[model samples]
Target: MRVTIDEDKCCGYAACLSVAEKVFDLAADNIAAVLVEHPQGELADQAREAAAACPTSAIILLDDTE
Candidate 1:
């Protein structure tokens, strides 16, 4: 899967980091960033959870099939 974050919509909540540290992290600007654009297996599941945990819905997840 492909993971991305809408920087404009991120509020620096760090929720994504909490859910998927390997896939997401806070940038110097405190916005959520995709550390691993493409994740697999457990990481992919974590990415999905991170997207759901995002209060602002800033995380965007695109399946490879798409």
Candidate 2:
């Protein structure tokens, strides 16, 4: 899976980081950043969980087909 973050929608809540530290992290500006663009296995699942945990829905997930 592919992961991204909408900077405009991010509130620096860090919920994504909390859910998946290996896949997500806070940037220098405190916004959520994708640590791994293409995560697999357990990391993929964590990325999905992080996306759902995002209160502002800033996290974006895409399938490989796209």
Candidate 3:
């Protein structure tokens, strides 16, 4: 799965980063920055958790599997 953040929608809650530190980071503006485009192994589930944890619905998860 691929994970991304909509900077405009981000409220800087840092929930995503908290859930998946290896997959996301907070920038200077407190917006979520994607550290990994496609999460593999256990990181994939972490990525999904991060997406679900976002209060502002800023995290976008794109499932590559069909």
- lDDT by residue (17-55, candidate 2, tens digit) is 888999988989988888899999999999999888899
Residue 2's lDDT in candidate 3: 72
Sort the predicted structures by lDDT, highest score first. 2, 1, 3
Q: Which TM-score value belongs to model 1?
A: 0.93
TM-score of each model, in listed order:
0.93, 0.94, 0.89
Q: Each candidate: RMSD to true structure? A: 1.0, 0.8, 1.7
State which candidate has the highest TM-score: 2
Candidate 1 per-residue lDDT, tens place, 1-66, comes to: 888888889999998888899998798999987889999999999999999999999999987777
What is the TM-score ranking, best to worst?
Answer: 2, 1, 3
> Per-residue lDDT of 1-66 in model 3, one digit per residue for the tens?
777788889999898888899999988988888988998988998988888888989988877762
Once superposed on the true structure, which residue ranges of model 3 sit more than 4 Å away at CA? none
Model 2: lDDT to the true structure: 0.91
Per-model CA lDDT versus the true structure: 0.90, 0.91, 0.87
